[model samples]
Target: MAENSSSTPPGTPPEDSRPRPQYGELAPEGWSWTPTPDERTLATPDAPVSSAAPVAAPHPRGTAPRWDRPVTLSLLVLGLLSTLFAVSMLAMITDSIQLIYTQLDLGGYEPDPSVPGLVTAGIVSVCLVWLATAAGAILLLARGRRAFYVPLIGAVLFVVVFIAFSSAVLATDPTLLNDPNLMDVYGSL
Candidate 1:
């Protein structure tokens, strides 16, 4: 028996097959490798695709493809810097709890309170969202996507997330509402 060119080998699937998405990954499960209608065609019958063909780029090249313009590179650098800052804040979250307790002590509050998981959850969630935002923007930047609005959208998302988490933190903690001193500190924050 003879095999047609269209027949995949018995032992292995073709390289063009779609992959299963990971848990929490942005790609939807069951997504196929087939190119979407919105995407540009990779190759033409007249010309085969080469390694450089992808980066050779079209005009404006959508967002900030590095080879096409300096803006993407600039955004990459800024995103990295902001990532570092956000990571530092995440690193310092534990210390902030100690500081919060100390302030409560200075205000003549009695015994030390064990840290609240709600507050911790809120803080960590906010930081993780921030990191995720930066990471998403960076990923888009690397992929040569038209991603100028990704970071902008991420910033807005951060504020909204912060507000939601902050409200939860406040609402759950009665001490913040009962004591004027704690309220002042929370308000300052």
Candidate 2:
């Protein structure tokens, strides 16, 4: 029979340079080539046991995985941008409210026929609510568990508000479309 040259010397592994078993493959006395549990039963009683340490079962990915850098950074950046946009919307609404109050005080300005005062108030209230929700979403992202979804929901709300606000402004002030700056940009394009 061919000699079992593969068998390691029966003692501590050689002090000379050699690869050490990383997982639970080496026992105190000698090397253990015991078949994995799925493949076969334990080695015969006379056969040298490979390892006294129990074989470690493979772990499922993501059970304790670290957050990937790119994904986490992307989500964080999105959340921050969403929050900033919501704040800007709130500021615009507040500024418009102030302008309306000033015009009413002067008794020389009138609300647009196409955009009623009630609709403007409603738009302002909606913007405030969006800002609050976006702030909450940004704060919740620190938990890192299903937090990215909050910002996504805020983004949808932002889109709805943006469309409604734009339509109202365009309906009330079609002349704004003729601004020299806008014409210049379009002409350049």
Which model scores highest in TM-score?
Answer: 1
What's the TM-score of each model vs. the native? 0.40, 0.34
Please tell me which predicted candidate would have the highest lDDT against the true structure: 1
Q: Per-residue lDDT tens digits of candidate 1, residues 1-189?
A: 444556776767445545644453756677645546654354334566576636554656445544433554455456556645654554454465446767777443232233355445656765676567667766876666766566566667666765664555445445535666876666664
C-alpha lDDT of candidate 1 relative to the true structure: 0.56
- Each prediction's total of clashing residue pairs, residues at least 3 apart in sequence or on different chains, is 1, 1
lDDT of 2 at 12: 46
Q: Please provide, for model 2 over 1-189, each residue's C-alpha lDDT reduced to its tens digit, 9 standing for 90 to 100.
A: 444545767654534454656575555665566678754653335556776887766546423224433454465466557656654654465356445445444323344664555355545655665566556644554444334455566667766776666556545643343445544544664
Off by over 4 Å in 1: 1-115, 178-189
The C-alpha stretches of model 2 lying farther than 4 A from their native spots are 1-83, 86-145, 176-189
Please, what is the whole-model Cα lDDT of each candidate in the order they appear? Answer: 0.56, 0.53
